[model samples]
Target chain A: MPMSPEAQALLKAARKHPDRPSDEARTRMRRNVMRAVSAGAGAVGATTAGTAAAQTLFAKIAGGALVVAALGGVVVGGRALFSSSESSVDPKNAPASTSTSTTVVGTSRETSEALGSTSTAANLDPTSDRVVASSALRTTATPSASSVASSPRIATAPSKPAEANITSDAASAPAVESVDVLKEEAALLASAQSALGKGQAARALELTNEHETRFPKGALSFERRAVHAMALCALGRGTEGRREAQAIVDRAPGTPLAERVSAACP
Target chain B: MPTPNALRSVNAPSAAGGVIPVAATRGSRSTTPPKTFDDLYDDHVDLVWRALRRFGVSEPGLEDAVQEVFIVAFKKLDTFEGKSALSTWLYGIAAYVARNVRRSQRRRPETPTEDAGLHLTSASDSPEDEVGAAEALRVLHALLDELDDDKREVFVLAELEGLTAPEISTSLGVNVNTIYARLRAARAAFEQAVVRRRAKDARQLQKGGLPCR
Candidate 1:
């Protein structure tokens, strides 16, 4: 099954020379992601806002850090979780800041602009252990529904805009409702998978039940069933898990899901 | 226990190579908390971009696809309970977006353009090197296109992106044994594809078709 030398060479060369965006595109997309977050395009609530604010700041700091490192010839350290910035300028020891609430000094307007905004750096949140992006310093401070509609980039909105809880006419439309159902199904399945991965089989089963209640004939029924079977195996219900896995394998042979199911109980 | 070699090879050919220090950006998830959205984007944008391209998101639609992945990421960030590496989690999201983009593009096919392959060349690359790399990329994509979705994904994630079997399993929600099995099958299929393409090209040359170069 090993690739021939020529095929291997091609892959090695391609890997060595993978495509990437120009720095400009990277910055523009970063700004767009931030804009999307600020506009509350995905979901709405206190939790969403807090996470978005923190993310916005992280993007800013990351952008600034890259520019500084490039100019200073500082080989920024790997993804280490360092709390203090004692080695900020020293490339030899500097790790890219993943700290939620480190105070960044000498953040310039150029860096801000390069990151796709013209806003000044905001105060680091001292109260929270995580870095909280200041909402007041957001480039688009007043992110209204009207503004979200006006911007072409933001127009696409989150693929799951229904999660945003917007009760407008658009949200009530039948077509939009269908898409939201799928998105919610996916979200529930993802949470279930996360739970399974975390060894919370009972919790995973509960989420699956919630999914069944919300979406009995959901688009992701197959995926949900697979997760359910796996959870059953995890909880030591080998006979039931095997039966479920076998049903899926018989239905769809040679698929990843089939492979997963076969192995889940074996 | 194949570890996803988080970092790119140090001996990469050129500065224009634009190699991503994936490990440098994709922080170890061993003890680190779930990454902030900014951290996730900054750390793995290149990885996501490359994945989308390999996943068949055309260059024109590539940016939108990338945006969609992160927006989905933003919405689902809380669900990321640090079960898998950040890169793998993003890959899962990118895979979903890429599939959707490909599906939509299929419904509205665009006119094929001459500049179809990934634009990996940099200002630093010599014209000869640029041509070579571009052609190699073109051939690579052509071979990949022959693969079915499942095999293609396995090949792209394992061979092209350098994710380990376990990481791909976590991202894909497949069994690790299945991943290894698929990787083996994919490599063999890809080699056959290369051989078939070369044989066909040779036949064309013998029939006095244009030179490959």
Candidate 2:
């Protein structure tokens, strides 16, 4: 069919139909695009960043704590079980360096002095490592994790020697109410995961921070850290994300969480 | 756009891979690389958005759909060989994304273009023409909504967006002859619908209403 004049006029009008997006819309679109671009753009560098961020942030945060299962799937600060040699990798000594590669659990003499206890003094209480860890912390440190003292789940933690045994009991809690507790905490974790999956890294960060604040000694601390690292990397904070993820791997080497962290960070 | 001898050249990757590659166009006049995705967005967002609007995506979801197209294009940046005009590649993405938006949106029928939105009115247009254009577009889109998806798409692309039959074929993944056939049928259907709408508008005008349905 030949194009009618009326069709021509209408088509012209239709072709002019799209309004330029409002400045607000344009700004919003740009912000989202930039975020995605930076996120995806960073994906190439993510492995390195995730490891660096995990390693750096984890050590700085963990302080001198040896990674104990009782410390909510991560070591916060504690005595060095290692030999009397001064920390081979002291963060304090190499303050000039930006690399967190040297952040060892009790590597720095400062970390050892900061923690200042023999491994025997701060032994892991399979049932209450938080109790022991907190008892041995710097005065500036926060109280034994609120997550531990409050949640009834900790009360029943068996005096099992193995960290796995502590984790296993928490996972397979027998009481009906404890399952509800676990479910509630799991839902919070899921929300953070959902945000990350939806590409809302900022929202995911908020959720992860909230998760940490609300459940400091929660069982899914490692899981939360995983998502947190991923979100940071997705936000283009590669160095930090790598450090966080690498920390999980370093502290809990040979464990499932460490394996997952290693895979994700790499 | 003609397909290059190979799917991709190491020097000139497609848009799917990353940024737009440099094209040696305006030969000897330019040394710069080809336009980036941001450049592409600045050039074509309006075209994609308008086409999407005509293709049944409501205004509320328009921005997201637009962003999705660019995001896809950005990812597929390296895949964008100079095989087709950048616009064509973008249109292909926009159409598919808008269709997906439409598919999900069809469940709860919302007509932002019709109800609250008096879209397509221009500042230069006389108040009467502005209102008239809006009513005309409403009838146009309403009529457009009635045709089957195939006819509607062809009509929207060929008439409204003015994509050539070959471009339409490439963008829509249909044969060139099929586009011709569809465009022919679509135009006929469109003419018939316009006649019906004008007659309905006359009838409504005779009833003394200020605006035509």
Ten-residue stretch with the least lDDT total in model 1 chain A:
A72-81
Which ranges of candidate 1 are over 4 A from the true structure?
A46-266, B1-35, B113-128, B209-213
Q: lDDT tens digits, residues B42-76, model 1? A: 77788889898898776666665576566556544
For model 2 the local lDDT of residue A238 reads 82
Q: Mind giving the per-residue lDDT tens digits that candidate 2 earns over B1-213? A: 223222123234221233322222211123234444445565666777777777776555666556556545544443455556666666676666666556656744443545333222221123235555555466567667667667877788777766788987877777899989988888788778666655655565577643422
Interface RMSD for candidates 1 onward, in order: 16.0, 20.8
Would you estimate the TM-scores of all the predictions?
0.47, 0.48
TM-score of chain B of each: 0.74, 0.72
Least accurate stretch of 10 residues (summed lDDT) in model 1 chain B? B11-20
Give candidate 2 misplaced runs (Cα > 4 Å): A2-6, A16-18, A44-266, B1-33, B109-136, B209-213
- TM-score of model 2, chain A? 0.34
